[model samples]
Target: MFSYCTDPAALDGLAWFSCYLTTGKHMSIYYAVGTVLLLLAITAPLSLAFGFGGATAARSQILPLRWFGNTYIAIVRGVPDIAFFLFFVIALDQAFEYLRHRIKCPDWEAEVWQGNDFIVCAAAKLPLGNAPQWVHETYGFSLAVLTFAIVFGAFAANVLFGAMRAVPRGQIETAEAYGMTSRQTFWRVIVPQMWVYALPGLSNLWMVLIKATPLLFLLGVEDIVYWARELGGTKTPQFTDYPHGDWRMWYFLALLVFYLGFTKISEVVLDRIMARLTHGQAAAAGEAQRKAAA
Candidate 1:
């Protein structure tokens, strides 16, 4: 990383450490932390939105909608998350390319699938074959985000569906007696009350989501885990400015601490949010708060 790092053999001590951390590969690894956080920030809300929609659909009177929603929720719980991540990313990428192929090369005479290979026309390649490096990276990251959202959304749907059901039926009846339409009662009465019931489940889901971010490496994203392994491995002096013994344990230790800190902070925030959501409600948490106040 240092301009003085022109010759690896010439450097030693602090200069070597300085140059080692500043290397291009190491810099990219540092930036990969941001990639993980970005994935979390974007995926969290989108997943919740997907969950809410699925939960609503599951509760719908329409038979087909309920079936679809139930299927979505059931599939995730039944399947291992790693299996979904692996299968979905490949399937989704191919699905996109196939759609693009049909749209862009309708006249192509050859079949798109040859043996195990899924070959699409050059024009149908995602981000195009000649696209910039960043475009390819961005497209891959977007797919990863979508994959994470879909998988987690199903779990969230289950949690939210139960929360919706746990909202007392009396609340809905009371709203109906007050002349509220089904829509008004759902939004005003059921939705608001369900959060108090839902907070614990949602908080657990959030912590799981945080823990799952490391799986980004599986999706081919250069995430922190990938970097940790790469940078922590011993390198010969011929290949790097700073070469040393295996330090993977230390790097992983840092990751462990990072996650523990993140989850601890999340626990605090979720507790505050739960308290706010339960305020003045009829739930045990709310009752306890009122008792403390009295």
Candidate 2:
């Protein structure tokens, strides 16, 4: 990044360190930080939307919809996260390719499953075989995002379902007494009240989601953890410019700091949200706030 970065061998002290930190690989580490944040930004709301749908479905009067919602929450929550992450990505990828293969290659002679290998026609390849590097990266990142949303959504659904149930039965009855339909009671009374109950669980889920960002490496997204390990490993002058000893401890330390700082910020934000949601309500938190104000 600097004119003097050209000759790393002669530089020493701060000069050498500056050059080392400005390398192409180091820039990638910086970019990976953004990648981690982007994953969280995209995944959080998508997961919440999924959770809302699942929770609503679980509460539906329709037997089949309720069964589906209950089964989805049960299966996802029961499975270990790592196991789900690994299994679901492959299954989803194959499902996509298989659909495309059937649609695009209807007349093709080759069986998709030949022995142990799963093959698809060239045209049906995700991002296509000859696509640019960015397209391939985008495809992988999209898959990672979807995987995260599905897994986290199930947990969120559980939290929301309990929250929905916690809304006072008296409130629902009062709404009905006022001639409100069930849908109107749910939308007007229950939905507003549920947030005060849901905030704590959702807050915890947010922290868990933040911590899970490292799993992006497993999904081939080149997230911060991946870059940290790659850049922190022992390097020799023989292999590349700007050689350094094993610095993984320091790199990982930075990651540790980043996560803690992010988590702290989230806690602050969630606390304020909780405060807002609880304001003017009859819940313990709201009562406490009222008492303190008085």
Candidate 3:
């Protein structure tokens, strides 16, 4: 926000708008946009890592490992994501506090759950009763991040499992025939080759992850959607120097633009990755590269 303008009345049309958009609340709105982007950045890799592990687990010849992996993917698909988010955040939070309550307030226990409210000792609070506001915000954000990672990680695992299976089985056998150990063949051959098949599903999952960032609001994370709705509401001249009409539509539009720009960039990046993945494979993309080279 520009200094030199002490009063909102000093600002004219566009300046008024700029000042309005740059208010502390609006600055938080801007940060909220970053918050959503950072969420996608964090969730994407973490989900991919999880998916890889889960896919590996599901593929194991060992029955118990396979059952566990398959069950993880299936359970998430069965539950509604919103329900999982709602239930898990509170459940996880309370679980943490309950554990803390046991450790911290072992002597003074009047039951953790008294009807609807989850009462924990002051010391057992997630951010503590007297913690800074920022600490609470950070804690909420951490929960949101964990929620996103867990939900999307399951979906990613499903996609990756399919991708791993879609890789030609003969190639793995060929590696075995060449005297490569099972683990060596998995890393050196199957793992590297699986991406060509994985890219399509993973990219789609990424797009879904991008759109789902708005759900952070439902989790009380005060993300862009939350701030946009808050600051974009009408403000009276009596209440504030800058008065405005209902601006939720405008704020939502801005969010739409932000998401579109993010997805466009993601598309470009995923395309590049796919290009690299398909460079020497027997897919049409690899054939085209060969043709060009020839």
The lDDT per prediction is 0.90, 0.93, 0.86
Best by lDDT: 2
Q: Look at candidate 3 and tell me the lDDT of residue 136.
A: 94
**Model 3, span 179-288: residue lDDT tens:** 99989998998888878888888899989988888789888877888888888899899988888899889889988898889889999999999889888879877898
- Candidate 2's C-alpha runs over 4 A off are none
lDDT-based ranking, best first?
Answer: 2, 1, 3
Model 1 clashes, total count: 0
lDDT of 1 by residue, 1-294 (tens): 457989867878888778877888888877998998899999999999999999999999999999999999998779999999999899999999999999999999998999998888999999897999999999999999999999989989999999999988887898999999989999998898888887899899999999999899888898999899988888777876567889999889999998899999999999999889888988999999999999
Task: List pairs with backbone clashes in candidate 3.
Answer: none
For candidate 2, the C-alpha RMSD (Å) to the true structure equals 0.9
What ranges in model 3 sit over 4 Å off?
A: 292-294
Ranking under TM-score, best-scoring first? Answer: 2, 1, 3
lDDT of 3 at 170: 91
**lDDT-better candidate, 1 vs 2:** 2
How many residue pairs clash (N, CA or C atoms closer than 3 angstroms) in each of the candidate models, in the order given? 0, 0, 0
Q: Compared with the true structure, what per-residue lDDT tens digits does model 2 show for residues 240-272?
A: 788889999999999999999999999999999
lDDT of residue 121 for candidate 1? 95
Best by TM-score: 2
